[model samples]
Target: MPHDHPMTVDAMLKQEFWEALYQRDDRIWSGNVNVNLQTEVEGLKPGRALDLGCGEGGDAIWLARHGWTVDGADISTTALARAEAAGREAGVTVDWLHRDILSWRPEDAYDLVSAQYMHLPPALRRDVFTAAAAAIRPGGSLLVVGHSPKAMRQFDGQKPPEELFFEPEEITGYLGDAWQWLVETCETRGEGHHTDAVYRARRLEA
Candidate 1:
């Protein structure tokens, strides 16, 4: 899925790009947690969780409120600040880590690891997703939600190269079938073709 993009991967990976993105406005993402995430995780018993690319702390905060101890991490300092404030406002405490998830590996395993809409080139995405899978303790789950390639037309073709978009199979194939495929659905967001590819798999217990 690596192809030519108007912006190089290096540019997108830099903290400056994300910092500028978050600094552009008081908020970047909707403060609410992602619908796919909540729908898939709402029934699970709360445990330690990790939210990668956890912009604005919405998912992490939501998880904490639901009784999971959460560590929310992102590359942008500005985003982290906003997330911290939001977590405080929501009356939930989240341990926020500022680091580039592309290269950072979690030191502790989690009962669940979620990455929502963290689109990157397919190669880089595989590495990050692999690490996410590794960070899950046995019998835990990994949830990945992405902008399905089916919805690429909704992006106005301005940002996030098409190469970054993917279908559910691309993710399920990478880490192998060691996981039980729990959820594989392309949810329609609303009218007009907007959709999200949601994938959730539970790690097979040893």
Candidate 2:
């Protein structure tokens, strides 16, 4: 069955949207490193990593600090510049690319690919997942984290209403029948609008 709801906000392509969303507010996403990001990826050996929609480069810096070559991609040059500055300050090198995910392509495969809080419209979301899955090497992993549908009621923020946010089942459908489900859980975190749904899935080699 096809979901009829529009899944994406198209926030990446609009310069003004990014300017308003990112420009005067260059700071770490979530105001700190993603707790789940640290714990979930700690077990995997660091290698080439891609941070899709990397805002201010928090995760990218963290990954680079952990010994992975990080590519931080975002549509806002202002954001990318800020990320680069942070990377330099941290003494960690991260390749910052100002490219919209909808138009960007992987130059090569990666050991890890992550898209956090990038809630694309349904069709675009599927396209991105498929691309991200394909970009991972045989033994690599892919991670996506988004606002849970419940967040609409649990908190208040810019996140879309319940109708737009994702559910575990919806995410599973996006993964298709090909990827191996390593972890699928819906939980709340932070205060107010900070609560979100975190999901992690792995693509099998065989």
Candidate 3:
């Protein structure tokens, strides 16, 4: 977030915080797909996918172009609108939903459920991750990517409290034994100051 932006815990939980963020900038994220998402998913079988906190739909759009049927969900109307426009421009259709993933309930209906950079208070984040995991069907995958706490802590006042960032175990622990780890670790985001903690797991087929 920009130093001008307030990132209080209370502010982050409210939809207005994100709406205001989008309102402040025409485009906050790089329109290209996130690096971890691409590295982990590029060759995986494309299927039904739910993009939790889809942001501007870069990942969703890319997935659609690669053959996945995707649903993009986010809390900000501003972001969703941009995502829809981008989808249209890209000539791919994605079901976009206006939703706060923190409280959103989803079924075990997607072959993949992805949550990228959706940071929150750890307790709330566990709820968010559990809910997202529920959306993945048996034999499906769950992919989560977030800023690594270890490196992000160097940001001083610019970043959210260290508590808001996470370690790989902190994320993978949100899953029950029904899931098997595919990848669980952190890699430099290449910014030299930032690292990405990633967790990719597959729901065991019963």
Which number leads on TM-score? Answer: 3
Cα deviation of 198 in candidate 3 (Å)?
A: 1.0
Of candidate 2, the 10-residue stretch with the lowest lDDT total is 1-10
Ranking by TM-score: 3, 1, 2
**All models: lDDT?**
0.81, 0.71, 0.82
Give candidate 2's error at residue 67 in angstroms: 1.2
| Residue 109 CA displacement from its true place in model 1, Å | 0.5
Candidate 1, residues 1-206, lDDT tens digits: the string is 11222355677877877777777678878899888899999988899999999988999999999999999999988989999999999999999999889899899999999999888988899999989988888778889888877776533245556887777767766555543444434343532346677788787667
Question: Whose lDDT is higher: candidate 2's or candidate 3's?
Answer: 3
Query: Each candidate's TM vs. the true structure?
Result: 0.88, 0.81, 0.90
- What tens-digit string does per-residue lDDT give for candidate 2 at 1-206? 01222223543346556655665444535535677788668988888999998878888999999999999998878788888888898999999988878767687899898888776667777787778877888677777777765556431223353454665445656655553644434455554556666666766666
lDDT of 3 by residue, 54-148 (tens): 99999999999999999999999999999999999999999999997888888549998988988889889989998777777777888888887
The 10 consecutive residues of candidate 1 with the worst lDDT sum are 1-10
Q: Check candidate 2 and list the clashing pairs.
A: 7-120, 7-121, 7-122, 8-120, 8-121
- Overall local distance difference test of candidate 3: 0.82
Report each candidate's C-alpha RMSD, comma-separated, in the order given. 3.8, 5.6, 2.4
